[model samples]
Target: MSLDQAAAVMEQQARACRNMAAPLYADLLVHTAEDVRAGGPCADAVAGWTGAPSTAAVPLRLLGGVHALVLTGQAPQLARFYPSAGGAYRPEDADAAWAAFRAVVADRRDAVRGWLRRPPQTNEVGRANLLLAGLLHAVQESRGLPVRLVELGASAGLNLRADRFRVAAPGFAWGPEDSPVRLPGAWRDGVPGWLREAARSYPELTVVERLGCDVTPLDPGSEDGALALRAYLWPEHTARATRLGGALELARRVPARVDRVGAAEFLAGLDPRPGTLTVVWHSVMRQYVPADEWARVTAELDRLAAAGAPFAHLLFEPYEQDGRHRFQLRARIGAGPERVLAEAHPHGLPAWTV
Candidate 1:
């Protein structure tokens, strides 16, 4: 992509970051984008980026690299801009931070480019609350049988442990109350009756198998893998970071396997079992997939549905509704009609039941 196009995309991503409660990252990315347009060190650091500017997540990858530097204590000067590192965010400090950021990029140009070569793997454990709710809805419809879950784009596979994480909303709660990973502010509207019943009747899921696939799956047990996951998170969002830590600990106790395979290839090898509810789930990952591969993935989903074993497909993705981008939970069981279950924040908090 041209420098101009990349700059514009970064600017748009900056606005999105601000809207999503990441002002620090938004400010840093805005400056980075400007520096790129001005043909400076930041431009050189991003010179090797070859993915589509619009959807490559280029801005986030760059930010992740810088965040990694701060996390690893490689750039002490940049620590003042990171709230998670005990720095306070002041609107006036953005300019000085930008200068420091640019200097760091120039000094660590090769390291920054290395980050751009890989996709951001946020894992985003907070999103598990929404996915768990969707799973419960599917279970209620499918005779409450044990489920075998196969997730696409599972990243570190943290959400595979969703059933083990604590979830609380007004008038409802699920999972272990004492669990370290707590997801509060779960629903904007009151919890639905279906969800309440599902939680009450089946407090813990009988997950027979949990399998996931990603183009590059991260092992939560590895130091580098943990660093990558943490770096992708906006440093100012302490809650998300805490939840990730909890998920990592939980992953050590309750293990799940994530294969290094493409989504379509993973689905092609899956088949339904007669007595189990075979559920395919993914969250906020469909956009990154190529159209041709996604077409094949859809066909595989149809094949699973038609296989006659109890089946469900749950997805949480951005859907344009009335000219607004809203993330919605959608579910399809067997050959039944697709249902729009709820609308949710991009991070899966404060869901509004439909």
Candidate 2:
């Protein structure tokens, strides 16, 4: 890519980070994009990143590498700007931090390049609240049948243990109150009557099978895996980091199998079981899937739904509405039309019931 084109992508990512409530990342990425244009270490690290702009996610991957260095105590100067290292994020310190970041990249070119080559796996546990809300809605509609969940792009499969996490809205709550992963005040508005009823009727779901697929899955039990997962989270978001730690602990006790396969390939091999609700779910992952493969995934979903078995497809993804980006919880059960359950935060908190 041309220097101008690369800079444009970085600038676009910076804007997105700012909109997504990650000012620290926005400042660093904005500076990194300028450094790229000026022919420096930042540009060298991101060299050969040929993915399309929409699917690149290059900025986060680069940031993750830097964060890893900071976490490992390899970049002490840069650590002062990272909240995860017990430092405060001041916008005025961003310029000095960027210089330190460039120096780190220059000194650790090989390590940074390795990170850029790998796809980012955040494995956000907070999103499980929104995913569980969708599952509860489906369970209620299916009349409390045991659910067999199949998740695409499951990352570390941390969310497979979502049922074990607690969530609280204004007037309703679900899961164990004493659970390690607690999502207090999860919803933006008052919980809907349907959700309340579902939570009341079934405080916990009967999940017979928990299976997930990802082209590259991380093992939450491994030290390297845990480090990589934590590195992707913005240092400023302490709640998210804490939640991830809890989810990792949960994963140790209750293990979920995540297959190393693409989404379409995994779906093609799945067969819905009788006397159980077969639910296919994904969150914030559809954007990474290619159009042709996603089309195949949709066809497979339709085929599974038509097999005379109880089935549901749930998604938490961004949908453009009225010229704005809104992440929505949508579901399709059996042959029924799609339903928009709620609008949610990207990290899966503060859901507004619709």
After superposing candidate 2 on the true structure, give the runs of residues whose Cα lies further than 4 Å from its correct spot: 50-52
Per-residue lDDT tens digits of candidate 2, residues 1-354? 676688788889899889887888899889888988888888888877734474778888899998998999999998998888887778888888888988999999999888887788888887887888889999998999999988999999999989999998766778987788999878886887778888888888889989999999999999999999999999889888989999999999987999999999999999889899999999999999999999999999998989989999999999988998899999999978989999888888888887
Lowest-sum lDDT 10-residue window in model 1: 46-55
Per-residue lDDT for 53-165 in model 1, tens only?
56789898999998888899998898887987777688889888888889989999889889988898899887887899989998988878999988999999999888889
Candidate lDDT values, in order? 0.89, 0.88
The candidate that wins on lDDT is 1
Residue 133 in model 1: lDDT: 90
- lDDT for position 18 in model 2: 92
The superposed Cα distance between candidate 1 and the true structure at residue 197, in angstroms, equals: 1.5
Clash pairs, candidate 1, are: none
- Show the lowest summed lDDT stretch of 10 residues, model 2: 47-56
